[model samples]
Target chain A: MLYLQVLINGILLGGLYSCIAVGFSLVWGVLNIINIMHGSLIILGAYAAYFAFTLLGINPFVFVPIAGVALFVLGYALQAGVINRVMGAPVLITLTLTFGLNLILENAMIFAFKADYRKVIIDPPLGLIEIGSAFVPRDRLYAMLLALLLVGGLYAVLRTTRIGRAIVAVRMDREAAALMGVNVPRIYAITFGLGALMAGSAGSLMSVIFPISPLTSVAFLGKAFVICVLGGLGSIPGVMVGGIALGVLESFGSLWLGPDYSTTIAFVLLLALLMFRPTGIMGKRGFE
Target chain B: MTGGRLLMAVAAAAMVGALPFMADNYILRIATSMLMYATLAMSWNFIGGFAGYPSFATAAFFGLGAYAGAVLQTKGVPMIAAWIVAGMIVTVFAAAVGRAILHLRGHYFAIASLVIADVLREVINGMTNLTGGGMGLNLPVLKIDVTTQAQFFYCAMLAVALLALATSVILDRSRVGFGLRCIEQNEDAALRLGIHTSRYKTIAFSLSSVYPALAGAVYASWVSYIDPAEAFDVLFSIKPIIMALLGGAGTIVGPVVGAFIFQVMEELVWRNFLNVHLGLLGLIVVLLILFLPKGLLGIGLLSPRGRPLTAKAP
Candidate 1:
C-alpha cells in the first residue's frame, strides 16, 4: 500500500516535472542555448499567479494562461533584442549570457519580493480522494491534469500548426529553413517565447503545491537540466518519460535515503547517464 | 620576454608586495581578495581559456581543498603541510574526474562539471561526524596579532598568485601549451595530427585544479571556519570565469588584469548599490558579452597587427 501511494505521488509529481522541462527542452533543442534564465522565468510566472490570486481574487489555475502570455512576451523580446545578437558566438558565450540574464532576473525578484516564500491558498482547501487505501490530494491531481493538458496542447500545436512546423523546420536545419523562406530569427524568438510560456504555466501550477521563492529557482533549474538530459534533449515525449522516471526514482530514493539525499541521488544519476549514455534513453544520435 | 616588459613586471610585483606596509587593514583585505581571485582566474585559464573547455568545477575543487585542509587541521596536522596535501588530493581527484568527463564536448561538459560541486556539497553534508555537516567546521586560530595575521595571509596569497602567474607564463610557451591551443582551435584536427588530445586536456584540467585548491586551503585557514555551503558556493566558479573573460582569456596577463579591474568594480558597485549589486553585475556581463566579447585585452593593445587575440579566421 505504501508502494502504491508512492507510485501515485511520483506520477502526479512527474506530470508537473514534464511541464517544467518542456519549455527548457524546446529552447535548448531549437536555439542551442541552455537558457539558464529558465528557472527564474518560471519563478516570475509563479509570482504573477500569486499576485493575481491575492490581489484580483482569481484562482491560480485560471491565471495560468495570463502568466504564460506575459512571460511569452518577455521571452520573445529578450531573445529578439539581446540574445539574437550573439547567435553566432560560441556556446560558452550564449551560456554565460543566459547566466547573466538569470542573475538579473533572480536578483530583481529578490529585490522586489524581499526573498520571502509565498504560497497561494485555494479557499476551502480541496480534500484528498482515497483510491484502494491510497490517498491522492485533490489539488495535486488537478495540477497534474492541467499540466498534462498543457503539454498535450503543446504537442498538438507542434504537430498541426504552421508556426510549429516553422519551429521544427528551423530546428532541423536553420540555413535550409531560411532558404525555404522561413524567418529563422523570428522562429527562434517564437520558440523561446513558447518555452517561457510553458515555464510560466508550470509556475502557475507549481505555486499552489510548492512554496514560491526566488531561491527555489536553482533547484528547479537543476531538475530541468537533469530531466532534459534524462529524457534526451529536445524531445517532448522524452521529457515526459524522463520526468516520470526521475519522479519515481526520487520518490523511492527519498523513502530509502531520506529526503535530503534525493537531490544527490538525482545528480549522481545524471552524471552516470551523461557518462554511460550521452544520448539518453529516448534521444537520437544527432541530438546529443 | 622583453627586458623592458620584464622590468615593468618586477616593478609592479614590488609595488604589490609593498602594499601591506602602505595600506590599512581594509585595503590589505581587498588586495588579498584580489590576489585570491587572480589565482582563481589564472587557474581557470589553463582549461577554460587555453583548452576551450568550459569547466564549472572550480567550486568543487575549492570546497574539497577547504574541507581536506580543515579536516587535516582538525586532526592536528600543521597548516602549511595540510594546504600542500589538500592540493595534491584535489590534483589527483581532478585528474581522475577529468579523464572521466573530458571527452564530453561543449554543453555536455559544462553541465557535467557544474554538477560536481553540488554533488560534493551533498556528500560533505551527509558526513556529519567528520565534516561537522551543516553546523560547519573550525580551524585552530593562529595566535598572532590581527595586523600580522592580515599581512601573513596577504603575502601568502600574493605568493600563490605569483606562482600561478609564473606557471601561466611557462605554460603559454611550452609544447603542451601549444598542444592545448591546437586542441582548442580544432580537437579533431589536433587529434588527427597525432596530438594526445585527451591527455593534454586532462593535464590542463589538473593544472587548473591545483592552485584553486591551495587558495581554498589558505582561505579556510584565514577565515578559521569552513562550511559545505560557503566553500561550495557556485559564485566561486562563476566569478573567476567572468574575470577571465573580462580580461582576455588565453593570455598570460589577462586573468590578472581582469581580476584587478573586476574587484575594483565590484567594490564600487557593492558600496553604492548594495541591494542591486548582483543585478548590476549581470547587466555588466550582458553588456560585456554583447559588445566586448574578447574582453578588455582584446581591444588591440596587447596583440600585434591590431587584431583581437581571439579573432577567428574570416
Candidate 2:
C-alpha cells in the first residue's frame, strides 16, 4: 500500500515536472544553447499570474494563456535581439549570456515582488481526490491534467504545423534549413517563444500550488535541468518519462534517506546519469 | 624584462606595499577585498581563461577550504598551517574531480561542475558536528589591534595576489601556456600532437584551486566565521569568471585590472542602490560578455589589434 501510494504521488508530481522540463529541453535542443534563464523565465510567468490575479482579479488558471503570450513575446524579443548575435559562438558563451539575463530577470522580480513568499490561495481550498488506495490534492490533479494537455498540444503542433516543421528542420540542421529557404533565425526566435509559452503556463499552474519567491527559481532551475537531462534534450516525450522516474525516485529517496538528502538525490542522479548515460531515456546521444 | 616596465612594476609594488601604513582602516579593508578578488580572478583564469574549460567548481573548492580551515582551527591548529593544509587538500581534490569530469564537453561538463558545488555544500551541511550546519562556525580572532588586524589581512592577501600574478605571468611566457592555448583552440589536434591535454588541464585545475582555497581560508580566519552559504555561494563561482572576462581572460594583468575595476564599480552600485545593485551587476556582466568579450585589454591596444596590451609587458 505504501508503495502504491508512493507510485501514485510520484506519477502526479511527475506530470508537473514534465511541464517544467519540456520547455527547457525544447530551447536547449532546438537553439543548441542551455537557457540558464529558464528558471527566471518560469518565475517571470508566475509573477505575471500573480499580478493578473491580484490586480485584475483574473483567475490564476485562466491567466495561463495570457501569461504564456506575454512571456512568448519577451522570449521572442530576447532571442531576436541578443541571443541571435551569439548564435555562432561556443555553447559556453550562449550559456553565460543566459546566466547574465537570469541575474537581470531575478533581480527585477525581487525588486518588484520584495522577496516574499506568496501563494494564490483559491480562497478556501479545493477538496482532495480519493483513489482506490491513496489520496491526491485537487490542485495537483489539475496541474497534472494541464501539464499533459500542454505537452500533448506541443507534440501535435510540432508534428503538424508549418512553423513547427521549420523548427524541426532547423534543429536537425541549421545550415540545411537555411539553404532550403527557411528563415533559421525566425524559427529560432519562434521556438524560444514557444518554449517561454510553455514555461509561463507551467509557472501559472505552479503559483497556484507552491508558495513562490524570486529566489525559488534557482531551486526550480536545478530541478528542471535535472529533469531535462533525464528526459533527453531534444525528445519531447522523454520529459514525461524522465519526470515520472525522477519524481518516483525522489519520493522513495525522501522516504528512506530523509528529506535533507532528497535534493542531493536529484543532483546525484543527474551526475550519475550524465556520466553513465549522457543520452537520457529516449534522447539522442551527445546533447541532442 | 624591459628596464622601463621593470621600473614600473617596482613602483606599483612599492605603492601597494605602502598603502597599509598610510591608508586608513577602511582603505585597508577594501584593498584587502580587492587583492582577494584579484587572486580569485587570476586563479580562475588558469583553467577558464587558458584551458577554455567552463568550470563552475570555484565555490566547491573555496567552501571546502573554508570548512577545512575552520575545522582545523577548532582543533587548535595554527592558522597558517591550517590554511596551507586546506590548499593542499583542495589541490588533490580538484585534480581528482578534473580527471573525472574533463571528458564531458560543453553544457555536459558545465552542468556536472554545477552539481559538484551543490553536492559539496550538502555534504558539508550534513556533517553537522564538523561544519556546524546552518548555525555556522567561528574562527579564533587574531589578538591584535583593529588597524593592525586589518593590515595583517591586507598584507597576507596582497602576497597571495602577487603570487597569483607571478604565476600567471610565468605561465603566459612558458611552453605550458602554449600547450594550453593549443588545447583551447583544438583539443583533438592538441591530443593528436601528444600534448597530454588532460594532464595539462588537471595540473592547471589543481594550480587554480590553490589561490581560492588560500583566499577562502584567509577570509574565514579574518572574518572569524564560516558557513556553507557564505563559503559555497554560487555567486562566488561566477563573479571571478566575470572579473576575468572583464579584464582579459588569458592575459596576466587582465584579471587584476578587471578585479580592481569591477570592485570599484560594485562598491559604487552597492552603496547607492542596495535594493537593485545585483541587477546592476547583472547588467554589467551581460554588457561586458556581449560588447567586450576580450575585456578591457582586448580592445585595439596601442601595440596592435588582436594583441592584449600586456603582450609586450617585458
Candidate 3:
C-alpha cells in the first residue's frame, strides 16, 4: 500500500514535469534553438503567480492563464526582436545567446524580488481522497488533471488548426514552407509564444508544490532537459513516458540512495540515455 | 615567413624568456596564471573550435591532473615528474572516454562531457581514503626564493603556451588537420572520402586533454593546495571556450588573443563591477553571437561583402 502510494505521488509529479518540459521540447523541435533561458522564464511565471496570490488573493489555478498570457507576450517580443536575427547561425551561437538571456533574466529577477524563497500555499481546499488504500492530495490531483487537459489541448491545436498545420509545415521544411506562402517568421513567433505559455502554466502549477527561488531554475532546467531527451524531440507521448519514468526513478532513488544523490540521478540518466540511445525513445526527428 | 616575421618571433620569444629579470612577483604570478589558462584554451580549441564539438570535460582533466599532482607531490615526487605523470594519466583517460562518447553529436556530446565532470567529482568525493574527499589535499611548498620561483613558473607557462600554438599550427597544416576540417564540414562526406573519422576525433580529443592536465599540475605547484570544487569547477571549464569563441575559433592566434582579452576584462569586472559582472559578460557574449557570429576575427563578415580576396567560389 505504501509502495503504491509512492508510485501515485511519482505519477502526479511526473505530470507536472511533463508540462514543464513540453514547451522546451516544442521550441527545440521547431526553432532548433535550445533556449537555455527557458528555466528563467519558468521562474518568471512562478513569481508572477506568487505576486498574484499575495496581492489579489487569487489562487494558482486561477492565476496560471494570466501568467501564461503575459509570458507569451514577453517571449514573442524576445524572439521577434532579438533571437530571430541570428536564427541561421550555428548551434553554438544560438546556445550562447540563450545562455546570455538566461543570465539577464536571472539577475533581473534577483534585483526585483531579492533572493528569497517564496511559495503560494493555499489552505487545503478539501480533505484528502482515499481509493484502495492509497491517498492523494486534492491540490496534486488538480494539477495532474490540469496537465493532461493542457497537453491534450495543445496536441489538438497543433494537429487540427490551420496555424498548427503551418507550424508542422515549418518544422518539416522552413524554406519550403516560406515558398508555399506560409509566413515563416510569424510561425516562429507563435511557436515561441506557445512554448512560453506552457512553461508559464507549469510554473504557476509548480509554485504550490515546490519553493520558488531564482536558483531553482538550474534544477528545473536540468529536469526539463532530462525529460525532453528521454521522450525525444517532436514526440509528445515520448515526453509523457519520459516524465513518469524520471519521476519514479527519482522517487525510488531518494528513497533508497539518500536524498542528496536523488537530484544527480536525472543528469546521470540523461548522460546514459544519450550515450546508449541517442535517438531517444520514439523520437521522430533524430538528434542533430 | 621572411626576415621581418622571423625577427619578430625571435624577439617575442626572447622577451618572454628574459622576463624573470624584469617582471615583479605580482606580474609573474599573473603571467603564470595566464599561460596556464591559455594552454587550457588552446587545448579546448583543438576539439571545440577546430573539430566543432564543444566539450565541457576540460575541468575533469584539469581536476584529474591537480589531484594526481597533489597525490604525487605528497609522496615526495618532484614537480616536473608530477606534471608529466599527471598529463599522461589524463591523456590515456581522455582517449578511452572519447572513443566511446564523442560519437554523440551536438549538445548531446556537450552535455555528456558535463556529466563526465560530475561523475568524476562524485568518484573523487566518494574515495575519501585516497583523495581526502571534500576537504582536499595539500602540497608542501618547495623551498626557493619567492621572486625567482614566481618568475620561473611564468617562463615555464610561456613555454607551454608556445608549444600549444606550435601544435595548433602543425595540426592546421597536417593531413590529420585536413581530416578534422573535413569531418567538421560534414561527417558523412568525410567518411565517404575515407578519412577514418573516429580515429581522427579520438586523437584530437586526447591531445586536447593534455594541456589542461599539465596546466592543472602547474597550478597545484603554484597554489600548494587544492579541493574538488575548485579543481573541477564548471566555470573553469566554460572560461576557455568563452575565450576561444571571443578570440575567433579555429585559428592559431584566436585562443591566445581571447585569453588575453578575457583575463583583462575579468580583472576589470572583479575590480569595478563586482555584483553584475557575470550578467554583463553574458550580455556581451549574446551580442557577439547575434551580431558578430564569426567572432572578433570577422571570418563570417567576408562572405557578405564578397570582396576579391575574401570571396570564395561557393
Candidate 4:
C-alpha cells in the first residue's frame, strides 16, 4: 500500500512537472534559446494568481488563463524585441542573455514579494479519495488531470491547427519555413508566447500544492533542463515521458537516499543521460 | 605593443604595487577583493573566452580549493603550502572532468558543467564529518595585526592576479592559444587540421582552474572561515563570467579592466540600493549583450590607437 501510494504520487507529480517543462522545451526546440528565465515566468504566474485570488476572492485555478495571457504578451515582446537580435550569435550568448533575464526577473520578484513563501489556498485544500488501501489527494489528481488535458489539448492543436503546423515547420527548419510563406519572426514570437502560456498555467497549478518564492526558481530551472534532456528536446510526447521518469526516480531516490539528496538526483540523471544517450528517451536525432 | 604604451603600463603597475604603503586598510581590503575577482575572470577567460567553452565549473574548483586549504591549514600546514596543494588538487580534478565534458558541445557542455558545480556542493554538504555538515569550518587566525594582515592579503591577491594576467598574456601569444582560437572557430575543422583539439581544451581547462583554486585558497585564509555555501557561492561562479564578458574574454587586459569596473560598481550598488543590485546588474548584462556583444575590449575604444583588439573573424 505504501509503495502504491508513492507510485501514484510520483505519477501525479510527474504530470505537473511535464506541464511545467513543456514551455521550456518548446522554446529550446524552436528558438534554440535555453530560456533560463523560464522559472521566473512560472513564479510570476504564481504570484499573479496569488494576487488575483487574494484581492478578488476567486479560486486560484480560475485565474490561470488570465496569468497565461499576461505571460504570452511578456514572452512575445521579449523574444521579438531582444532575443531576435542575437539569434545568429554564438549559442552561449543567447544562453547568457537568458541568464541575465532570469537574474532580473528573480530579483524583481524578491523586491516585490519580499522572499516570503506564498501558496494559494483553495476552498477545499485537502480532500482525499481512498482507492482500496491507497489514498489519493483530490488536489493532486486535479493537477494531474489538468496537466494531461492542457498538454493533450496542445498536442492536438499542433497536429490540427495551421499555426501549429507552422510552428512545427519552423522548428524543423526556420529558413525553409520562411520560404514556404511562414512569417518566421512572427512564428518565433508565437512559439515563445505559447510556451510562456503553458509555463504560466503550470505555475498556477503548482502553487496549489507547493510554496513558491523567488529562490524556488533555481530548483525549477534545473528540473526543466533535466526533463528537456530526459524526454528528448523537441518532441511533444517526450515531455510527459521525461517528467514521469524524473518524478519516479526522485520518489525512489528520496525513499532510498535521504530527501535532502533528492535534488542531486536530477543532476546525476542529467549527466548520465548526456553521457550515454544525448538524444534522450523519446527525442529524435538532429533535433536534439 | 608599442614601447611608450608598455612603459606607461609598467608605471601604472608600479603605482598599484605601491598602494599598500599609502592607502588605508579599507581601501586595501576593497582592492584585494577586486584583484581576487580579477584573478577569477582571468582564469575563466582561458577556457570560456579563448577556448569558447561556456563552463560553470568555476565554483566546483573554487570550493575544492577552499576546502583543501582550510583542512590543511587547520592541520598545521603553512599557508603557502596549503595554497599550492589546493591548486594541484583542482588541476587534476579539472583535467579529469574536462576530458569527459569537453566532448559535449554548445549547451550540453554548459549544462553539464553547471551540474558539476551543483553536485560538488551537495557532496560537500553531505560529508558532515569532514566538512562540518554546513556548520562550516574556521581556519586558525593569523597572528598578525589587522593592518599588516590586510596588506599581506592585498599583496597576495595582487600577486595572484598578476600571475593570472601574465599567463593569459603568454597564452594569448602562443601556439596553444592559437589552437584554442581555431577550436573556438570550429572544433571539427581544428581537429581536421591536426590541432589536437581535445588535448588543447583539457589543458586550457586545467590552466583555468589553477588560478581560481589559488585565489580560493588565499580567500579562505584571508576570511579565516569557510563553508560550502560561502565558499561555493553560485554568485561567485556567475560574477566572474559576467566580468570576463564585460571586459573582453580573450584579452589579457580585459578581465582585469572588467573586474575593476564591476567591483567598483558592485560596491556602489550594494551600498545604495542594497536589495535590487542583482536586478540592475542583470539589466545591464542584457543591454550589453544586445548592444555590445563584443564587450568593452572587443569594441576597442580603449585599444591603443583605437584599434579593435583583434580581427573578430575566425
Q: Which candidate is the best by lDDT?
A: 1
> What are the per-residue Cα lDDT tens digits for candidate 1 across B88-155?
99999999999989999988999999999999999999899999999999999999999999999998
lDDT tens digits, residue span A50-97, model 2: 888888889888898898899999999999998887786765567778
TM-score of chain A of each: 0.98, 0.96, 0.97, 0.97
Query: Model 1 over residues A10-45: C-alpha lDDT tens digits?
Result: 999999999999999899888888999999999999
| Model 1 misplacement above 4 A | A285-288, B1-7, B304-314
Q: Candidate 4 residues B16-48, lDDT tens each? A: 989999999988989999999999988988888
- Tens-digit lDDT track of model 3 for B161-212: 8778889889988998778877777778999989999999998999899888
lDDT by residue for model 2 over B1-314, one digit each (tens)? 66876797699789898999999998888889999989988898888888878888888888888888889999999999999999899989999988887888878888988888899888888899887998899888888899989989898888878888889888877788878878777799999999989889888888788989999888899899988888999987888888888888777777888899989987766789888787888888788867887788877441111223121100
A61 Cα displacement, candidate 3 (Å): 2.3
C-alpha lDDT of candidate 4 relative to the true structure: 0.85
TM-score of chain B of each: 0.96, 0.94, 0.91, 0.95
Question: In candidate 3 chain B, where is summed lDDT lowest over 10 consecutive residues?
Answer: B305-314
Q: What are the root-mean-square deviations of the candidates from the true structure over C-alphas?
A: 1.8, 3.1, 3.5, 2.1
Shift of residue A26 alpha carbon in model 1, Å: 0.8
RMSD of 3: 3.5
Candidate 2 Cα outliers beyond 4 Å, as residue runs: A285-288, B1-7, B301-314
CA lDDT of every candidate: 0.91, 0.84, 0.81, 0.85
| Candidate 3 A-chain TM-score | 0.97
Over A1-288, each residue of candidate 4 has an lDDT whose tens digit, in order, gives 888888888898999899889899888888777899889898888888888878887676777788889999999998899887777667768888998988888998999888999988787566999998998999889988888788887788677899999988888887788899999889888988988898888888888889989889888889999999999988878988999888888888888897898898889889989888887999973222
Residue B89 in model 4: lDDT = 92
